[model samples]
Target chain A: MADKVLIYSRFPKTMMARFAERFELLDTGGKPAQDVFSGNELAGIRALLTAGGSPLGAEAMDRLPKLGAIVCYGTGYDGVDLKAAAARKIAVGHSPGANAASVADIAMTLMLAATRRILIADQYVRSGDWASSRQSPMMRPQAGMPGRRIGVYGMGEIGRKIAARCAAFEAEVGYFSRTKHDLPYQYFPSLEALSDWCSVLMIAVRAGAETQHVVNADILKRLGEDGYVVNISRGSVIDEKALVAALSDKTIAGAGLDVYQEEPHAPDALTVLPNVVLSPHIGGHTLDSHVAMQNCVLANLTAFFAGRPLPHAVKTA
Target chain B: MADKVLIYSRFPKTMMARFAERFELLDTGGKPAQDVFSGNELAGIRALLTAGGSPLGAEAMDRLPKLGAIVCYGTGYDGVDLKAAAARKIAVGHSPGANAASVADIAMTLMLAATRRILIADQYVRSGDWASSRQSPMMRPQAGMPGRRIGVYGMGEIGRKIAARCAAFEAEVGYFSRTKHDLPYQYFPSLEALSDWCSVLMIAVRAGAETQHVVNADILKRLGEDGYVVNISRGSVIDEKALVAALSDKTIAGAGLDVYQEEPHAPDALTVLPNVVLSPHIGGHTLDSHVAMQNCVLANLTAFFAGRPLPHAVKTA
Candidate 1:
């Protein structure tokens, strides 16, 4: 008998077809698989496949009594309640290092965008400024990143990648992590100290209760009037209200934000602020990256059901 | 008696006062003495304190027979004919390296602007797209730059500085120069070879007959489909017409230009293009850079007249 599988998030048909080849696959089309777990839709389902950012709450875990394995299809498994899943002896696994390069790419892009004033210059050109150009005739040339200091908060894999890029720009790269790494660049004991030293600060730490508001009002102030801040990590990592106020008052030079505190429904004030550059949260959503994340999920699922060591077991319990 | 000094460029009051105290300063209120060079005005001036970009042809040099020293206020003596100046035994000095850091900063800014999609995203928000945003809602997360290869055309001081900035962004930097330097990064032998390897190429070489259109159609095509070109050097360094055609056809990714073939007026086709970013010729004209350049020019003038070594003498005939 095949292991019954329920997919809770969107995936390419190719991946779904691959899953169907081995398991008793059921496509949820990103709908909440409450029926499958509640024993109403289908019984004896042994596997659960879900992507990151899906709501797999305690109630959802309690319903899936027969679920032997739960595989997260992306890097962050914050949405799922790990303790509940662990209590049921359900093996939880999440994909890791799948989207590092792509996320790193986006981080660099946001930093560059914030520093260069690219968006502003383009709008000036587009608003029929050719004949009577406001910026062209008497524009101040932009300050580039060379000889500038760049600070990275949370020197994880993504943070390290960003640091390498910042280093390439001839910026003195510094970092603030919980524990110091054996690296040549200077390590600040705290984010506030790091922010004070850097003209451009990039937040690349994970988002959680402990790491939430890592870049709070105090650290923001330390960034100073000529400093820019970029967040490519998680929305919960920064205090969006404080960021908006800082930007409005010109306490910070600018911000380039990929993820916000409340995403999709970003604060209306942030969108209106002239000093901020905003992007919809899509850091790890590249076609190449998505495929990589999906492959990892599939590999983990395959190993779990085969009674072998899973490739990326989350160790949630 | 002290040599009669003619001031042509507009400088700050503090700088002006400094020059006045040192020489018999003749203030022309930012206008280059077209009449004075034609023997129509200021006929008895023994020394010329002119800025670069002043048209000093053979006739102008011939008219100024008493001109013992020609101290240009900036680099690039293309405006002042070196052959003519040398024939008249005029000591031509220019302010070099004074504004290099500022210009380098702007170059990195332009490159970052082109790579990061700053203007495009800014317009998306400013155009009331957030509330009724089509791109944001259905968008897969986009990628930005990290681990991208950046090519610098000239490995001079400015080019080296730009490389340093590229490093900060985690960019793998390479450069093509006539001779190799003992730098930390990789060096390419030719522009074509560099174009083949780099996604973003920066032009920072001196502009003249020998170096004109160094980035031509062939090299641009070699930069390939997803490449971006940034020109912060002289406008003559790039083939503007070819760049426009490439941008029109989407041959390369995009371009960020600060200088143009014609000052004040850019090509209408280039101005209208969506993919390219344009700036008026303000690459090295920042307030800080201007003051620095002026000081350098003053120092060159003071030293030349005092029979001290000229600070920034232009190597010319």
Candidate 2:
């Protein structure tokens, strides 16, 4: 019999179809009516196709006794309890850096939207307001991207790509990573220092207990009246309430946010603000990104089924 | 006595104040009231502080017999009859290459907005539709900028800056210019060929009788179903009616436009289209641009009064 695989989350239809060809595909196919199967169904599951922030903690891991590998669809795998999976000798694999360019590109998109007031400008023309006045409602002049100081909070793949794009726009790119690197970007040791130094602060860190609410009221306030914030990472990385207050109160000039504290439900506070550019967390959903991610998951799955080391294996330590 | 200067359009109050320090000031000051003076008043007008497409053509030039220079605020003097100005020995001045960075930044902004469906994304969140569905209304996956071919219709300073910015994003930049330069970008001599070769076509050429409506239905249709168009140049460069038909019929993918065929009056056809990102003609209206344009006009005026070659004199021939 083909080895049974638990599809813990939805994969691209093509990927799911391809997986079914090689293994017995089971579990919920993105149906909210049923997410996890009974203990008996998962008991003999040898592998699982999943995504970052999945519900694959100790409880789910305890049920899947035959599972040898958990292949995550996208980069962040914080939901998988690596320590527990390691104790059970189950390797975890994820598509790392697969969507960095897409996410970074979105970050820049948000930056331009907010800074240039494109949202308001579009509305102004659409609403027939421009007919009455040639000048757009007295917006602060956008000095363009060049020569502006851009500070990235997490200098990972996404952050690095953002920095690279910023440099191309002739911006002064800097980062506050955990450890200093020899890269040309100016390094700041702490978030506060980076916030203080740059005109724009980008949040691109992973979401976890340690990083929860890393950007709070104080950071937003420190970013100051002229500063701009753009977050393309996990929504939880920023304190939504604080962000709302900052934008509302003009503590910061504006924001471009793809993710929010709640999925699907954008905060009421941010929804009403004119200075912020809000999206429904579409950082890595590009056509190219989805294809890359699927290829990564398939690589890990194929490597594992053949009794080889999984590509992109996440270290348990 | 200060040389009389007709303020044909509104400049920033600060620029006006500074100009007052140097010369006699005049205008309706952005009011909708009468701008042109009586024929008796026009006879003494020595210079005019105006912008592109102002009513300072041969008729107005004929009226202002004493006018030696028509100082345009920003580039693009197509509205002025250069041959007539040459016949009359009336010099023209415009701030060249002043707002290229800002306009290119906006072009990229509209490209991202149209491809990523950012305008709809923003509306989805604001309309509370996202709360009902986590997935944004099914959109064709936007391929990120990198490796995508960006074609330019004009290879002027603005086009060069745009290509440089695109290269930074890892896009393959090419252009269709009348004269080929030995630059890194691939050069196509014909608009149709460039449209066929590129995923994104940028309209950045100047507007004139010869160049008006250059991007007609044939050019847009050549761009095909997968192509995107971004225009930061004169709206007359595009055939507004043909573009509307193409967009309505899905002959082309999408468009990001800052200029329209008529100022302040957005085309009713484009207003309802979902695949377009529209902005009123505000591409070069930034604060920095205003300052630079004022400086150019001032430089020309100062040089003209001082009897030096007008610093940015437009060649009549």
Candidate 3:
């Protein structure tokens, strides 16, 4: 008999089909499977497939008498209820570093877009503002990436990848971490010093309460008028109000934001500002990444069913 | 007494002071110096300063009988009447390879922007299309640079620099030139073969009658639906009509265009396309590049006045 797996989100079609072969997959994209789950179907589910955004609360945990494992299909397990999972003694696993390459790609893309004034240039061509016979209307030259000093706020997997790409552009790379790694780049013990030393700062730290508002008005001021900030990490890491003020006052040159304090709703101030490039919090949501996440979920469920330690077990407590 | 030099276009402010020290300068920006030139002020004009777009015609060449040299500030002296200058035994010098670094930067920028769908992604965030709490709307993962094959249409200075940048991103690099250079990348004798082999093709050849519309419907078809085209060279290099049709029909995935077919006006066909990224041909217009251009102009004039061989002298006729 196949062990039942309750799915809380949709995955790549192929991977979902693969999961169906291993276990009887229950579909619940918007909400939990309510109708069948209220009966014996709920009792049969021994594992849950969740994502970074889908949490398994204690209330729901109490109803699943046989639930033993929770598999998350993204680098971040931010939405997972760690305490609840710990109380129920359920194994939790998440795909770690699966989307680092794609996320790193966006970091550089956003960096170049903001600095190059890509939006303005695109708008310039579309608006028919260029004189037919004259030289293309001269716009400000970009503060290009080459030779620019870049500071990475965190030196984990994604941060390391970002540094590597920036270095390839001939930009000097630096990092701010508790302790330095075995990298050739310069390291600063404090974030403030790193901001002062670098013109472009890339955020790639782990998200948690401790890291909230880590980059605030003072840090923005230290970044100065020629400095640019790129955040691919959690939105709460930056105080959005302070960032807006800094952008408005020219305390910093510009910013490239992939994450926002208010997801989906970027502050209106950012829309009007010509120097910033904004994207919906999709630093890692590539199709390649989506497929990778599904594969990770499969590996986790397979390991759990075979009475083996989860390959990427996330510490619950 | 200093020899006279006719300044055809505006140069950087500091460079003007540098020129003032070397020669008696004459400014004729909008139209030719009609009144002054007809006067004896043009009598000692030993040299003329010309740029890529601002040409000195046979008529103007005849007026400056004493002209011994033509110093161009940009890399391409496409506009200067080479045959006319040759007839009078005039020394023509242009800044070659001064723009390689900056132009290479834009090529990669366009490559990433178009493939990543950056402009559309930026618009999506601004348009409030992403769901606030759910996973940010899934976007197609760009056929990212890593592990992808990139074909350079011309193996010139700018093309070599672009290949280096792409290799850093882990993309496999190839090239198509009249003849292959001593490069590690795979080389094709024909553009069609190169197009079929690579997913992304960057055009960087010199503009002339022989190269016009080199990438037309046939090349686009060979590149196929997954292919992307990026042009950083002359606008006339690619067939705009064929490019638009390919983009419209999804025959080619996308394009990143820095130059256009019609001087300053981009076709409306390109404007409505979601997959194309357009810029007003400012690839090498950085302030740093401007300073470099001034330095080159100064070098040519300095070498000419000293009766030494011109540093970047272009062969005329």
Candidate 4:
């Protein structure tokens, strides 16, 4: 008999197909646990798979009396209540670094797109403005990557990758994290210091209470008029209102964003901005990233069902 | 008094301001030389400034009998009839490698944007498709850059820079050039072989009669269904009609083009395509690149008037 794993998030059928082959999944269809499953059914579930961003609280964990594992499908587990899980003795596991390269790739994509004003250029060509020889203010020459300073907000897997890529473009790389690692990049003690020194600030920090809205109006002001921000991390890291204001009044040159304060929906102000380049939250959404993450999820689940420690368990303080 | 220098090509007033300070520029306002200037005015012009892509055939050269030097304002001098210039003992000069970094940056921008389907993602967010949780075929997870094969068609300055940037993203780099240099990348013997080996083909070859329409139907076919091509070089290098056919039929995945067979006019067929990311020959249009090219032009012109060898003269066999 296959081990029953509760799917607490609504994932596309295609993404769940492989897992379905290995486990009997009791899907909640993105609803409350009690709404979709009876007390008996919920009590019998031993493990659950969830998107890293979905809210999973202690109360929900209590419904599954037999739940021993909480497996997150991506690098992040921000929405998982770590204290609650720990009190319940639930082993929290996540696919750490599985999506780092892909996320870093998106960061570079967004950075290049925003800095070079590629979206504006594309529109200029598509609208026949180029053929007609029409002039555009946005068509003004932009500074290239060489000699540009790129400040990274976090120095984790994705941050490190971003730094390496920026360095390759002949740009100077700097970072501000909780602790400095022995890397080639310059280390800053604070985000403000990093922002002041670099022209482009890349947000790659983990989303949490400490990081939420850390990049506020002050930071944007420090970034100055010629600076740009590229966020591939959680959108909550930036104060969206401040970003909108910065972009609007030219406090900052522009922004390229993949994540937002609200997922799936970016603000109307941001979408309508000519200088900004916005994309659906897809930093870690590559095929290779998905496969790597799934492999980790499968490994964690298999180990949990076997009454063993999770092979990819997240270390919590 | 400033030496007479004919402005043979139409440039924006701002771009010409610095040149005007040093030369007695007879601006034609993009009109035919005969229409804009009298024979006497044309005869006095000993040196001229031109855009690298504008036509400067033997007939145009013949009109300026005292034309001792032809200074191209950018890296390319393809517009100049080299044979005619050599026969007339006219020294041809250009800003060699002046815009290489900027052009390479654009190439990377286009490659990342097309491969990641960034435009579609941007639209998904802006159009509220993401908020509705609507699925898009274009939203399917894409292959990231790491370990991906990038074939560079030219091993010049721009090509080398592109390879370095791609390598920093952890992509496998390969190349095919007329003469192989001691570079770190794998060198293929021909463009066909390089296309066969790599998924992304970057065209950076010089544009001339010998290389006209080099990337045709057969080459695009070789690139295969999952392949992408990016051209920062001149457009005559690729057969546009064949490219349209290949893209329409999904013979190749997509293309990122900065130049076209016709200047200032991209084909309606190309502009309408979703897979192609088009720019209006803005590869080397960065302010830094312009300043670099102008400096080279200044040096070339100053040397020409001083009866010294053109400092940045293009050697003719």
Best by lDDT: 4
**Considering DockQ, where higher is better, how would the candidates rank from best to worst?**
4, 2, 3, 1
CA shift at B97, candidate 1, in angstroms?
3.7
Among incorrect, acceptable, medium and high, the docking class of model 1 is: acceptable
* Per-model root-mean-square deviation over C-alphas: 4.7, 2.6, 3.7, 1.4
Docking class of 2: medium
User: Considering every candidate listed, which one attains the maximal TM-score?
Assistant: 4
| lDDT by residue (tens digit), candidate 4, A107-205 | 999999898888888889899998787989899888888889999999999999999999988889999999999999999999999999998999999
DockQ, model 3, C-alpha based: 0.58
Candidates 1 and 2: which is better by TM-score?
Answer: 2
Sort the candidates on lDDT, descending order: 4, 2, 3, 1
The per-residue C-alpha lDDT of model 3 at residue A9 equals 65
Model 3 spans with C-alpha error above 4 angstroms: A1-4, A7-45, A53-65, A81-84, A132-138, A315-317, B1-44, B53-60, B132-138, B305-307, B315-317
* Residue lDDT tens for model 2, B183-259: 89999979989988998999888777878898999999888887888998888899999999988898988999998
Where does candidate 4 clash, by residue pair?
Answer: none
lDDT scores of the candidates, listed in order: 0.73, 0.81, 0.81, 0.91
lDDT of 4 by residue, B156-207 (tens): 8999999999999889999999999999999999998998999899999988
DockQ of each: 0.30, 0.69, 0.58, 0.82
Report the Cα lDDT for residue A80, model 1.
71
How many clashing pairs per prediction, in order?
27, 0, 0, 0
Residue-level lDDT of model 1, residues B3-55, one tens digit each, is: 66877554434456657766787776555566434454467765777656556
